[model samples]
Target: MLKYIMQLYKSKRLKVKHAFSSRQGGVSQPPYDSLNLAYHVGDRRDDVVKNHKLFAYEAGFDFKKLVFMNQIHSNKVHVVDEDSFLVPSCDALVTNLCDTPLMVMSADCAPVLFYDEVSKTVAAAHVGRKGAFGNIVKNVLDVMWERFGAEAENIVVAVGPNIKLCCYEVGEKEKSEAKNLGYGFALSGAHLDIDAIIAHQLQKEGVLKEHVEFLPHCTCCESERFFSYRAQGETGRNAAVIVLEDYV
Candidate 1:
């Protein structure tokens, strides 16, 4: 059984559940050693499957109900409904339906999990450099607002472990992109606070600042606990999953 390294905020009267897992307590190998959840990263297929199973079990979820995306790092937000249990080629996913576990994969990229108990909606987002620039966070908020009648004030967001500014060095071209977007000073060279940018975007979308929680752990700095693509080029992936189970 995989040990869950997760943080939880208690709330009654809602079935919402979520977790940001670290890269520990599983079976893989060196380079991609142990707890690698992504199957596309050249890890052993069987081990990957087992790892997924262990993760689901540990996180108190069913493996079959878990939904994943191809994570193109685009602004596309797929609204998951009955017929769309599995969406294709999307970076963000939202749903008013309950019991479906939504997930976003990342190494250095940000994993943002959102829950709006009032609207009975939940979402997971992958916010990388390109996705952030493309306004993926705003897109997800818009979808939640329109589809589930979600109030920005009622939404709770968690910014999971990701590459912090200390290690997210970028080239001139990437910096220029943010600059052109009117967010010129967001990136601080060889270091970018992508999580903070996403948080600001959430505020822009009317989500209250107090409703958002930022996890201060850096993937690159704490590579032993979480996978860091920037720290280890061509490496494994970690999962940040959220599922709304049946209310007891």
Candidate 2:
């Protein structure tokens, strides 16, 4: 049995079961080349399903209880308060529901996880250039605070691997757009730092600086290890997921 090597989340304060999947260790073949957790991509349905079961088994969560997002690259956020498998048609999934795992998929895009230990709430969002400029982080935070009592200062965030500025080149118009959005530092000539913009958004919304942690992995440069749509054009997607520790 090929085991999925998980990047399990470790937090001293947040009681949640969370893990980020990489591109290695699974049953998929060729372009997917094993461990592609998304069904929307061109990977075989059976392969994606097998990968999900393996991921759940390796990560110690019930695949049957997971909640997935139908990401649309918009700032729309849906709140989950029940244990169900229905995928929400939104870019972000916010939930205070225990044992109900939330998932967001990505390929050369940022996958972010949020946790509020004080309110025992958790969220997952898929962000690319569109979501980055749309302020998806603020939308997630707003939903968290309004529906659940999650405060910005109490939210702990983790931004997973994505295509960094070193490889995420944009046109002159997009570069100027980023500069006008108060992200001049995200500009390196024609490239934009997508993750940096996301981190800045988190802090701008009152999330504590110490609570934000983003991995330094660049999917485009590390495409051989992690799927990158920007590099491969057509590729499998990696998944970032989170769930409250207590199950109903």
Candidate 3:
């Protein structure tokens, strides 16, 4: 029900609702200039909380049911239940329970949301290139499969908007990081496709290519719409959130 919203693939199957929010529809000011969902990005805490309330209202969830992480760009996945809301500092969250909204923040890093219709479980992950190098997607799949009885084949994934490869130019240092992880190849000039790397990891983990939907909105390129950390240093953060409601 959010004004600025993008639906995921098979969203209706889960009987839940979600949105990949853009830089529209909230109350932050220039530099952060509207709809910034992060508190640590130099925005006032009051504004951030107010923005969260507005976002929750628009996204069709109660503010109390929403949960956020401190996201450190690591491969850490938080297994969230009723008690998990109080703790922060993890980069990903998985919930089989209902009514709790799981969210991941990103300026350019990939925000991946997963749902298992058969099991009625949901998860959200923040996949920065560092996280990609850490194989965050693989870790998420492993946890979903191992803990929640979520079969990889039945796990529906939606990779939300992020910086694409064209504008996501990296240095040799980033390339080295990827190679050090033993995954992904280096181009001659040190550029890497973080999105491609994520997709490959998903497929390797057994998620069907068709089931994994990508938003394909490049944050850096589409500056008018989405936020980009690379392009706008210390700018606002766009959030990708999903929640299961009692009714569709």
Candidate 4:
């Protein structure tokens, strides 16, 4: 009975399974209450494992085949395969292997999923402010193209929920830094529109506008459904996951 935000990118050439998990429909406690997919955020290990099992069951993937990153807010991209089961220290993960899920855990930071129909590859990225400033999105695209023979034009991206500009307020230093990175700031230099920044990055990398899908929910604003670290201080992490299904 677990609910997920599912996005199926389908074309005549290929199809990819992508899902963004909400804070609902699992067993945990207040703050980490229900469906918390991350273990490092102080959530009990047993609860996290059970939650993953539920998520895997609902999302139609094996929990044992899932690979997660120890996200360090860097631009590092790990090019993985079925044999690359060990968790690595990176912000993004790309793989062409079927049924092996690449997952990114995030609270307020953006969880971006990528799929190239032509190459039948999938990627998941943890794009926080630091990661975005480090150009993680472009790095992921580069890995996809160079390692998996993925074309920019054939890539479809899904930007999952995060802290939008409506509630994401920032100080001058952060705003100035983002501006220095050539990204514009909003709310008169108080808020940063991270989704817009990532979209611009994808476009700059030659990803088509029509192929990029942005989930419009703000994690901080919608605390009832999504866990927001920015709002809750010590919060559990939500996940964005993608897997290439076996071609039939």
Clashes of each: 2, 0, 1, 0
Pairs with steric clashes in candidate 1: 29-33, 169-190
Q: What is the lDDT of candidate 1?
A: 0.83
Among all candidates shown, the one with the greatest lDDT: 4
Per-residue C-alpha lDDT of model 3 across residues 1-248, encoded as one tens digit per residue = 23544322223333458877888887788787678899989998888898888888877877887888999999998888766567567788988877888889999999989988877888899998888888888888888888888999998888888888778787777777777776555333556778788888988889988787787688999887888988888799999889876655
Model 3 Cα shift for residue 223 (angstroms): 1.3
Candidate 2 lDDT over residue span 120-229, tens digit each: 88999999888989899899999999989899999999888888889989998888888888888988888888878988899889998888877778888988778888
Model 1 error, position 15 (Å): 8.3
Query: What is the C-alpha lDDT profile of model 4 across 1-248, one tens digit per residue?
Result: 44544322223222477688888778888778878899898989999999898888887898998899999999999988656778679899998888888889999999988998788889999999998888899999999999989999999888888899898888988988887888874335587888888888899999998888878789999987888987889889888888989987
Clashes by residue pair, model 4: none
Put down candidate 1 lDDT per residue, 66-121, tens digits, no spaces. Answer: 89998887999998899887689999999877778898999989998888888788
Order the candidates by lDDT, highest first — what do you get?
4, 2, 1, 3
For each candidate, what TM-score against the reference? 0.92, 0.92, 0.90, 0.92
lDDT (CA) for every model shown?
0.83, 0.84, 0.81, 0.85
lDDT of model 4 at position 77: 91
User: Roughly what TM-score does model 3 have, to 2 decimal places?
Assistant: 0.90
